[model samples]
Target: MREDDWLAARFEENRDHLRAVAYRMLGSQQEAEDAVQESWIRLSRSDPASIDNLGGWLTTVVGRICLDMLRLRRSRPEQAVGEHSPVLADHEVPDPELEAVQADSVGLALLVVLETLTPAERLAFVLHDMFAMPFDDIAPIVGRSPAAARQLASRARRRVQGNPDIPEADSSRQREIVSAFLAASRSGDFEALLEMLDPEVVVRADEAVAARGAASLVRGAAAVAEHFSGRALAARLALVDGLAGAVWAHRGVPQVVFAFTISEGRIAEIEMLGDDDYLEQAELTIIEK
Candidate 1:
């Protein structure tokens, strides 16, 4: 095949993985698409023969583009935060059968945790932790020394481990938490709800379109119980990204799907995808209201 044809085929084959990386980095499917498209443009103009590891090279290109995007957009409202907080907290719809060794790495909560790091830190950590890219390979990707990359990964690890967020788990365990959350909400049992959450829990929605950050970031079990005493049932629960979360149904129509990040068994972070326009890109369904 001609070089261009070969590049095209490779791009097609790697599109999904490329987009996943971009999306996780930037937290906006539109932004990720833009980054990937830009990478393709660069790829089309380059000589393929000089490339040794096309997959790794393409991923680097996309990662760099995303990093630049993150940098350039730093002044905008969407300036990369410690996380991509969506206005609608409960709208994630992930493919149940998607197979991959790192499927659990892309949780909304985890992504938010990723947001806390600087661009270089995020890149270094993701390449080393999520993809298992060697520190030597990761150094050039972030324009840091191999030692620096290693340090960045180490720092990122410390932050993640220190923060009391629950590590992502299998589907059955996910269902257990979801079920417990849902049951607590539906049964009007505040004590049961308290038992399901961790002590230092926070409930925040995206400020881009959200009006509130936790109604109350209660400290202990009793405080959590007090907060949920009469308010739990007002919200509706749905399975998002294979975890239990809330979906706001307006006028009997699903308007937003929110996803939560659980840590230490409590809600550590909450993200909502309220931009209805971006729902389709995320493969999510938005009902009426």
Candidate 2:
């Protein structure tokens, strides 16, 4: 067989697996099919000789594509559930067979839960927990260390299992961790801040915060630690949206909110919210330290 024919055969062999991976990453079957097709396009363009494991390589490519799609979906305004309901009134018959197959592959309830997770967390959980992919392979895809990838998967797993709410004891422990992080930031204790942060911790700010010259996104413990060192002196311990977090208030009115996602006793994600609309909608309770 010619090289192109051989490559086509190899790709055909892995199509179903790639489609399954993409479907889990993206809840929409149409999007999953698109992701798989894109992966095949990439494979065809690359030098096959360099690929020792085509299956693994294809999986990684599909993962990256799905992650991008998920992020893009999040960036846009959210649509209400059933907004895309089939327009059966137009006399278009729905395919019961196809619907059953899709439902059997992944339940709608689980997909709803997965949609709540961040792109990185969803990818980590789907690849490591669902597909049995190792964290080492997943780390590079999500741009995190192996340990951090594991943490993401663990956190996602907890959410997927319908245990999204932190237990009372876990909440108290998280409060202590957030308090320590605040103290370290106020005192410019960079080392201490690093200790409480995951090696691949991520910090994201809203447009309002970023407009003030703060980064929209920062990754890595060292970078995040450096950014927070000697800062947050005015930020007080608070509960933002029922999570252990902090708020920087002016005259008792919150000007900024720091929502933290803690896992494995380390801060895995921090979201800086300065948007007026979000602040107004969030339930903020300043905790007396």
Quality of model 2 by C-alpha lDDT: 0.83
Give the Å error, residue 42, model 2: 0.3
Top-TM-score structure, candidate number = 2
lDDT (tens digit, per residue) of candidate 1 on 184-284: 76677887877777776555333322543444233565665566555545446665533456676667555555566666556655455444432332222
Q: Give stretches of model 1 more than 4 Å off.
A: 77-103, 164-289
**Best model per lDDT:** 2
Per-model CA lDDT versus the true structure: 0.64, 0.83
Instruction: For candidate 2, write residues 1-289 as lDDT tens digits.
Output: 9999999999999988887788778866667779999999999999999999999999999999999988888787576423222222345454453355356645667777888889999999999987899988998999876645766787788889898676799889989999999999999999999999999999998778888888999999999999999999899999765578999988988888898999899999998878764576566789954
Q: What is the TM-score of each candidate against the true structure?
A: 0.49, 0.54
Cα TM-score of candidate 2: 0.54
Residue 18, model 2: lDDT of 83
